[model samples]
Target: MLDEKLLSRALLDDDKENLMKRLLLVCVLGLTPLLISGCQSAYYSAMEKVGVHKRDILVDRVEDTRDAQDEAQEQFVNALEQFRSVVNFDGGDLEAAYNKLQKEYDRSEAAANEVREHIEKVEHVAQALFDEWEDELEQYTSQGLRRESARALADTKSRYKQLRASLTRAESRMQPVLSALLDNTLYLKHNLNARAIGSLKGEFAGIKADIDRLVIDMQRSIKESDQFIKAMQH
Candidate 1:
């Protein structure tokens, strides 16, 4: 009636102001986490400079990695059991079976990711420790002490090589199991009928074989982790 154009312009301006405020808030919130992460990393770096050292960090990370791998092994076993159950599923609520499989798959995925992350953490600290040791060798004034330190570093590296190989092998074994899991999960998701049970039957043998292999690999990795931890403790 009166000044409709002026009223619309005012409303548009108000909306823009609110939108800008929201965007500003979102950016600040997002940056806060990144800022905190940077601060934590800086703190660790500072601690290392003060003689806390990456060797200590490596030991902690290795223990964490070992525990994570153990947990992952349990999770994968549970997922395999669930997979076996679905394949042997008789006439029952198809939805329930699908849900269980989905849950197990999600859990397995999370556990596997945790294991991989822990391994990366261990590797990061280990590399930093080794590099620092090598660099510090030149700073040694006494020839006898320098030689001793060099020998210790070489021995540690050799042991780490074996441990890393075992851990990596265990990590690599997860892919086949995960792939098998995804295949069955997707198949069930698409065909949520009784036939979905039958569809998974053909995959059981291969999955069983994969799980058996995974279990063995994980066991070997765990043993390696224990030995490495013992070596570090000594």
Candidate 2:
């Protein structure tokens, strides 16, 4: 009886070992692929949340901002044209017209400032991209990155000069005609002479010529800026 019991125990031990081995193999075969697939799915989902598709959602917002900027520029140009038609401030209605001019100046200043802020934001983001792009990968932001940067600076200067010129012109228009007017003035507000207007116009002509040169230089700088920015981003 003892011998019989020993043989039965040995057979039972063998069956247990085989069952465990089969269970382990089944687990490895079934679980390995599932584990890998789960990891892959999670990685893709995370990327989708923070990747290019997420960024593209802002495309409309960017477009809207650009559209608003264009409208502001149009309004500013119209206001400038209107200024050209004005008879100097001596028309005895000085207060109203002067106030209106001031308001337009404020409006233009606001719009220009908005554009500057937008550009600043773009620059800031471009800079941030360097962590990933410049070190390891390449990123695309603008073709004229270098140009935009240089132009941004130049545009800032140009806008400032234009604002200053506009302010001076506003003051000149308000000046009592007798204070600066001699004769042959193109603009007349009542008995005021027009010589001072011609003189002012000449000064502005020179300033405009300078502005044109600055603009050309800025344009050239923009291309170089684009290349530089691309290099840095990449």
Candidate 3:
């Protein structure tokens, strides 16, 4: 008799637990859509408060850097063309090649200056973005934003990181090319067609090859910067 009563009670308890779960689930299903709608509405309404205009400044800055890099690459190509004009590999025209290299050096220098200006502009925009993010975080935190605060902070951090990476790549790409152009020309004057120029290369073909590689790398870097800017705007 005791065993029968215990079994009946256990079955009743299981049924009650199952019923409660279904009711709870039904209640949640009914409320989920309202909760989701409210969240979306709140998100857009919140984003407007962190106002800083990215209308043209950010894209324009990246585009300017890209243009400068392209121009610098073209100038390098022209430098190679100027190099091709030299009469002979003999020690005779060494001075002439040196003078030609100097002109190319000056051209490359101007291009580097433009790249620097664009980079500075990028830095300025990034700093503004950083300030906006901090302001928003502080304002929201004080108001007990909780989950929204965490999400906003994560998004802000990601944006800052991506922009920083893009600029770092641009600088990395531009500096080496500039330095290589300068150093390569100097080495050319010393060893035009002989054995290794500073143990680096033996002929014009090698210089052309290295320069070609740099051109390709610079193109990739500029594209990355453009993508990064687009990401920030979105």
Candidate 4:
């Protein structure tokens, strides 16, 4: 009887193992289409499983982009200050000065890249949500409800367009600043001397101007992001 009980227990454990394997196989098969569709689709599908829809992802991405812009503003300002210090070099280690300026440039470039990536994420999930919203309007049996939803979608799209334009403007402004930083960094890299510092002084004005414009545009974009997030939440 003990042997028979042990045999039963063994069979039960085997059944459980088989069940788990089957469940895992089912899960993989279920996710195959989403994976094949693309990374964005797979990401959205995974989020949906956790009850976070594309709309939520879009809002989160916009917030991230806004924060990135804020950080980028700080980075550019810091880079400008570093450049100022380097150009005002009063007999210090030229190599150290160049290294410091290079580090600043790298930080500014990384911040800009982060902002761009965040914007792309926002756009990706937004397009998915908007497309889904448009398609689902057809499933509504009530004409009044369909019209209302369509109006909402249109209003959301309009607001999104404004936000996108603001972001684009801000993004474009970064290019000039980055170019100026790159030029200064490269110039200093090749000519690490007091005379090189004198030449870079002239470049400070242009970089400062670009950064000022970039900051203004980024602030506007951040404000738009806040408005859009509030609107979406409602």
| Candidate of highest lDDT | 4
Question: Among these predicted structures, which one has the highest TM-score?
Answer: 4
Off by more than 4 A, model 3: 1-56, 87-98, 141-153, 156-160, 183-206
Writing each residue's lDDT as its tens digit, candidate 4 over 1-234 gives 211222233334443455443433343334574552354564456445445577877877788889999999999999999999998899869899899999999999999999997887688778999999999999999999999999999999999999999999999999889998998899999998878888998988888988999999999999999999999999
Model 2: per-residue Cα lDDT at residue 160: 31
Each prediction's whole-model lDDT (CA): 0.77, 0.37, 0.57, 0.82
- Score every model by TM-score: 0.81, 0.37, 0.56, 0.84
Which residue runs does candidate 1 get wrong by more than 4 Å? 1-41, 49-51
Candidate 2 local lDDT, 1-234, one digit each (tens): 211222233334443455443433343233575663344323223323323221221222233334444544454554443344333334455445444545555565565455444433333333333333233322335657755555554543454344334323332322122122212122333323345344444444333343344334333333333433333334
lDDT ranking from best candidate downward: 4, 1, 3, 2
Q: What is the descending TM-score order?
A: 4, 1, 3, 2
TM-score of 2: 0.37
Write model 1 residue lDDT over 1-234, tens digit each, in one string.
111222232334443455443433343233575663344344345444334455666776777778888888899889988888888877778788889999999999998998887787678668877887899999999999999999999999999999999999999999889988999999998998767777788888898898889889999999998899899889
Q: Candidate 2: where is the Cα deviation over 4 Å?
A: 1-65, 87-92, 135-234
Candidate 2 residue-wise lDDT at 52: 27
Stronger candidate by lDDT (1 vs 3): 1
On residues 185-215, what C-alpha lDDT tens digit does candidate 3 reach at each position? 7776666554523243334565577567757
